[model samples]
Target: MDTDVISAAIDFGLQKLSFTEIKINQRKVVESFLAGKDVFFCSPTGSGKSLTFEIAPFVFKYLQKNDMCIVLVISPLTSLMRTQTQALNRKGIKAPNKSSLGDVKEGKIDIIFSSPESLIGHERKLLLDLAKKNFIKTVFVDEAHCIKKFGLPDKKKKKLAYRPCYGRLDEIRSLVGGHVPVVALTATATEETKAVIKKQLCMDNCSEIMVNPDKKNVTYWVHNLPSDDICTNFRWLVNLLRGYKQATSRMIIFFRQIKHMADVYEYLETSLKHDAYIDFKEGGPNDNRNRLFDMFHMKTDDDVKDFICTSYMNPNGNIRVVLCSTSFSMGLDVKGVDTVIHYGPANDVDDYVQESGRAGREPSQQCNAILLTYKRCLGSQNIFPSMKEYVKSKTCRRAFILNIFKTIVEHAHIPHFCCDICRLSCKCACSCEDECVCTNTCNQVLPKINTAIMSNEDNDDSDDNDDNDITELDDMFSSDSDSDVLESSTRKPQVIYSSDDEMF
Candidate 1:
């Protein structure tokens, strides 16, 4: 391991980049790349996963003074590719928008950004050639969970999107062989999903590092409505949003079906009179979708000038709400989303995690997540155990999500404003007509338990001079913290109520 390379990377990040923090996980990731090991990483959204891969190569190239080093990035969406390329260019790195086999052979570009399909179809031979000669240092797959959607397509015509190009990622691995390192990055994935990614990419003995998935600043709420009254549910959602303090804050309303989105969009336009935008497939081409996105972000009018000058004030009533389906879930990065409202229950917990995690990206801003659903639709949508479990569960909502991904942390460390259950708030108003007892205990205040708090020390790898070794990396992974582990006694302990209590 080269300490100089790591140090140089940190210098570049702090001196040149914006809002950059060289986390311990990032340092370990770069170290693994230097040692020639494959990596499988799972962290929460807005955790800066891109920087982990980018810093290592930048540092490596700077140390060797090799401007010819080529790093290939494979993404599922073109929007994501553009986002990364633009960011890299801001850091003074040469990432070409267009390049050919001759350009790659001559090392005309430091990084090449392409979608999975383009890499497999247009640059297949060139990429394999670079791998054969060990010219490519690392092959990165961002949003690696797309492997499940595209790797094995369903024969039934129910899914909205499909791509056979993702299946060919395995071919890239076979040609690259064991000498080259491959890194798979994603914000959310279960252990089973992780296994599929590792196997699909032919990653042998890959290292796994999972950052804490719990988002402490965002509060979760569930609104249970009558299964038969769809109109009433929309009205209820409209009232909720109308009551929020920041009327112009960015919001995404996710619908399970396209028809439901259309229905709600009509109501918001006619009744609430909000400049709401609708985003879904089969509606129009990408140009229209891009226009709608700009409107929602308040980037399309003369008021945009004042909005930017005043830090996004919205004097001209800009578009704030976007009604969308699952297509809006992945690959789109919108910052400071004040709230995320699910028009219905998600297909499963993983989907719920990924969708809801979109909010509270900026740690300083508080965000909320609301799930509106009916009990009857839970089984139809494969929401097993029940949507009632989520709305009525007596446990901390944060704890419930963390337990799903098998994360272990003391309850005392969880934030006080964790969720509706932790705070004992029943906004659902579920009546007993459906045998739901949640309404009965809505007003009861549960006792908070006092326990030892778990804390992780802040480890600053930028200041360290020691070469990053495997032994230090193992300690970081085993402790289950993104950075360093601090002493529990130094922090104040939190009091959280247990979920098993009958009145919780």
Candidate 2:
């Protein structure tokens, strides 16, 4: 199992920390990184995905017996880039910003951190110069999902004048120039997003490591609240705070809109008035755009932690809660987060999964995820209408969530390929005779399925409403009915052949 290699990697990382911390999953990722292969890691937030790449260079340096630049971690969020650079510094490793390429050329750093845009200018010249001197090796794209839209739309532009420059990623590739291996990392990437990364990075053959998206250690429960009062929600939050007061835990509460964030913050401040123990950091959506930039350029671990707890007090303590929107969900890793309370229903399953994934990162069995929802007019419709898919799916909760990606991978056969893992693992496969293991499992469980059907039928017949519902039930059971045929199929068939001339 390469336990010594794993231990050495841990020892290397632990030198920077005062406390003892060992992450097995992080070690596995390090092993993959050391093999000089491109990886697409699907670990949840707070599961130490960043540390996986951070510790890889150290291992590579020891084994390869050289001090060359083995990693170039490109992050979309400035905050994340800064956080990573600072973390490297804490470990006595110099990971400077790409903007300081001139300084780096004089042997001032071992790693380079920058945004996709920052690497395109004079920075590419410096990197190429260093490459001639044999100094660069591996490239890591932190939030690789953004590479999909590498040069599409300026964030400053509000109108629809967005034109995509497809060659932007290609330009970066030309700069790197095939000398160093590239590892792209992300917490949430659809199949389309991954294809964009592969194409942009110019990786001919890439290996993927998919960490199960389900955080089973975190128990999930939803609350149906009656009122839309921010103050009322504050009281409920206060109760949660009191419960976790003494426990060493962190929390992130998600809001749907900027105005909702402001409302919640104001209500908490006023209602919890002068609660010296409580601290909050306000991350307004507009400000978050720049905050990400600042985070990428940060120079220390303390700065990274500070940004995480920006809106909360005692960030390093056992309990800290940051009230944020969707911006906080992607590529942010923190440990011992006991709860992630969504103040409102998420817009889609993807958003919900990513947000809920923040809890129970350390493999504990007692973590909790509380979702608070209410009936509110999001425009003319419910903002969370799509949640019905999750609630109504006949498949297991985990299977249903994973199938969302499977559907995408199936539909988007770009670069002339489909998801092989989905085909092998999904329950939708036909039979074991077709070389499917899930099909065998399904067949073995068919008796239970039959029992369930009988039980449902018995219950339906025993119901008091059965007699009154009989006429409607008869209409439903009439398979030959025109209404039934129309409702069952939404598509009109087209005739593809004519046989009148052949008959003559």
Candidate 3:
């Protein structure tokens, strides 16, 4: 890979850009577009991570033959793929998917965008063969966090299944040659998640870069309320939207479940009695998917701005308030997101951070990320206690986030552990933090919960099952931790504080 030529192409692209002036952080990302080095990048949303990878194929084009260098971006959302493919086509680039696989095989496509599920079947083999012949040069995993197994398993099987890939990533990687440099990009990564990703991609020695997580243009706030009074909360949301509507600003509201999404949309359309447009994705004759593309995509005649729907819809609408699930939190970037409201609790701290990071991408906009939950149900079993601890904790949010990554880093280095990436010892120094802040804050806060939830018998059963599967899988595919420092670290002194005033 000629790094100098790649840099020159990036410079040329940025010089002729319009609309938003490219930020310095984005320029730094473009500079790191080198070949033969797997890169793990964590940047805030709207910081131009997509642009960095968008220009990457140009680098390979400089080094390889014309149309010989193909770029494949694996995104989690089909809607996102469609939007990106449309945008790329407008730029006169050939980007196609299974719907147009014929065009791709006819040598009509320079870029191919697909979701993990669509990349698993017979069509993938043909692409894999072409890729091995050097037709596909670079692979980019957008919304890399989905590889960590988002609630897909839970929702699909109605239970939490821990099988990370569901046989997707492993299958896809096997098709592509090992030498093909892979790039994993996300807006949020806990130390644990980073470790998992590195191990999964076999990129232990990969260079890592992160843009500042704390955005000065965005404000963060948390509200505790009663779960039963959800309607009252919806009223507050309406008022919030009204306040922003007066300013003619755009906003997004994230929900936890599809049922809740439907309920909120119904309330807004009926009780609020607003002419605001609503779209739900329950598959049926009247399903939103039937008309979603025509309604949301700018190419359509729909002028609906107050888009009320689940995370499944294409988010191209000039909608003032987009009600969705956490699925909208990753990869897809929208500018002028003035506010992000969480109607329910998040699954974990990592989730909370990713969702909140969506607001205030524009440097001059005053955006706010508000976390609202019921006060009485704060200690509910369904709600992850770690989130409550984060909201109520006194430590710097950045320190807390870094600490999560540090633990995962240490876990990655331990030998004989069958992680997603390798089978042997991992030798990578994850210098992510100035100090380990988790030892004091998160260690002691959950002993009772851990003990109550985790039993010796449960451990034995789970361990036995995991060992049997690990041994079998490791043997089949050839893929696939310390006490003293742990105990002393747990004994450190700590401080705790409470929110004195209610945010709402």
Candidate 4:
């Protein structure tokens, strides 16, 4: 990194972005962008992925280049596009109105943040017009993994066909030019997914800068809930929250199903009675989801502690706690989160890596990631092989994730606050210390997987009246059926697959 670039980044972080210093990864990404290369950069959440793309306009401004030379960011969701728009506007940068196709063609906009759906539909003509004038210097695909899942529509599913823009991202290269730079940014991408992204995006000779996915500051663990009862799960969560209430206070609880989220919310809100600070959030069939989203991510001085929402709930505040779903994974940029608790094991280790990556984003703060799992969900879903191996293996958890990246690390390379296996082997620094070895006096504690039995309420056998008694939530899925809780085997598949591209 050049001294001028480094100094400029630091000044921008402190004065403009309100950060004390610029991150190394941020510097490298900016350098790459300045070099005019198409980049496939995989960095952990909160490591400044947004800044990598956002800084381009500022650099161009500094160079006294054509102000019309702008960056086009293609995000996966409307919520993310809105979030980016708000953040950039805060820095006094001009953000294109997402609804106005005319603003895209005007060439006065410094940057246009949009979704693939918007690009392929509303803004297609204007965006191509700008591309023809050589107005867009770079095109960024944020959360590029969605290009695989949401790209093509599964026409068999009517809802998915509504916005089949996800699969047509490769068409973005055509909208712009073949020679224009495309930067694909994602926090999590398996080796298989990477190959797919490269081919789909037409990045035959794209250079990649992948920082190690492991966050040494974040400690990982799996907690086996002894019972299948939702109440039992509730009790365990209360205890864990109470324990981490002090220094490592901020947290997010992730869920795999909407009904499970609703069920847990009922128990906590109705039974436990912590409704003010804690709330339930989910993507809706309408703007209701978006409204709850702004309340959480758009911080006001009045905001309080403990928001219980879906993974779609963005952590904007110095949120001490969150309860959400898989939608929370990828490209979330909140900092100083002390913990991330998954209500159950993720669908796969890749999902696990992305969700767990949210914690301990600030290098100065060591955070904890706890995965709570029940035996039944595992049996019903046939948990991913890596996830199954992750829970049962007597090896280093961090090393397991690293191996996913095809890197080999010996036991000797394990960090101080190592995983359960490393700690049990007496390889952790706290092994000899009666008090916890953590600088914060927190021990590498791995509670025995609970042996509690399922309550009758959680038992599978039930009368027909159970379906009639269910309450409707705001989401698209009907919670009354087991089809809602189980993985894809039982539910209506969200997207129909025409090729292997849709599988992941």
Check candidate 1 and list the clashing pairs: 456-486, 457-485, 457-486
Please tell me which predicted candidate would have the highest TM-score against the true structure.
Answer: 4
Q: What lDDT tens digits, residue by residue, belong to model 1 across residues 1-504? A: 557756766676455455456788876777677678899888788787877656655665665677567777777544345455666777776666643446766766667766666667666787777777666778888888878645655445343224556666888777666677888988888787788788888887988888877777787765445443456556644554455413445667776644455556556555644322333235544232222222121112223322322221232233455665443455445565767878666756777778788788877776777776543444332343433366556677777777777885444533335676666544234566765766353443321110000011122323111112112111211101112212311122221111111000
Off by over 4 Å in 1: 9-21, 98-105, 153-161, 227-231, 236-246, 272-318, 381-394, 409-416, 425-504
lDDT of 4 at 444: 43
Q: Which residue pairs in model 3 clash with each other? A: 191-405, 199-421, 225-373, 225-374, 225-375, 305-319, 423-480
lDDT of candidate 2 over 284-379, digit per residue (tens): 233321221111111223334345544232335433566664545656555556667776556556567777877666774446565665434122
Q: Of the candidates numbered 1 and 2, which has the greater lDDT value?
A: 1
Clashes of 2: 17
Clashes found in each candidate (C-alpha, N, C closer than 3 A): 3, 17, 7, 12
Candidates 1 and 4: which is better by TM-score? 4
* lDDT of candidate 4 over 1-504, digit per residue (tens): 466864674465346455566677677666666666678989878777887677766665555446676888877544445555656777776786535446657777777877776677766787788888988888888888766544544444443432356667778889898777888898888888788788888888777888778777777776555555787677644454334432225566676655566566455444433322323334423222212211121111111211223222343432344555555554545555667777666767777788788778778786677777664554423246677677766678888888887755443534436665565555444444565545432344443222111221244433222223333322222111122442312223222111111111
Worst 10 residues of 2 by lDDT: 495-504
The prediction achieving the highest lDDT against the true structure is 4
C-alpha positional error of residue 234 in candidate 2 after TM-score superposition, expressed in Å: 3.6
Question: Relative to the true structure, how large is the alpha-carbon lDDT of every model?
Answer: 0.58, 0.51, 0.52, 0.59
In candidate 2, position 185 carries an lDDT of 72
lDDT of 4 at 352: 79
